[model samples]
Target: MKISCSISFEQGLGERLMFFKRRIEKKTYDKSSKKPVIKSSICNGEQVAGFKDIATGAFEEIMLIKNQDDLVEFKEIYGISEEIEKIY
Candidate 1:
């Protein structure tokens, strides 16, 4: 799963994490029309996997990959990849 993020400064549980934003499209049923429709919106910076939850069917969550320090855990769980560092 590839995501785009710019510089981020935050505090608390998601502090060490850098901020990232991405625009996404979503599908939902319209109550008034009683039909399915696609809606597009922007998902703001959040916990690393936050977008994964929002993206839904657009992607399957393999591992809840995060910052550079998580590389060891990511490697342990998902195995080695040369491009892993690019995520942070």
Candidate 2:
């Protein structure tokens, strides 16, 4: 008698491929000119994670903050350890 697994070799390969595709690469931002910020909408309460220009007060949106995991991922990608500021 012989037993076999349910998942095929192609399916296993596809899963591995997806893992590689979703892997996040390390990124950097200008520390001297920009700081991490979370922009929250006053009415809808939507939040976005990104960097803000310190002098010019311009915001560069990076990712959507739907949950804590997404916020953590954003911090990890940019290697940010300090507290992020929030704005309206």
Best by lDDT: 2
lDDT of 1 by residue, 1-88 (tens): 9999777667788765544544333323223332211222246322232112223333223334355454344444433333431212
* Per-residue lDDT of model 2, residues 1-88, tens digit only: 9998653245554642232335678899999999999999999999999989999999999999999979888988999888789999
Residue range with the least summed lDDT across 10 consecutive positions in model 2: 12-21
Q: Please give the TM-score that candidate 1 achieves against the real structure.
A: 0.26
Candidate 2: misplaced stretches above 4 Å?
Answer: 1-22
Residue 32 lDDT, candidate 1, scale 0-100: 39
- Return the lDDT, model 1, position 16: 56
What CA root-mean-square deviation does each model show from the true structure?
18.2, 7.8
Q: Estimate each model's TM-score.
A: 0.26, 0.74
List, in order, the clash count of every candidate structure.
Answer: 1, 0
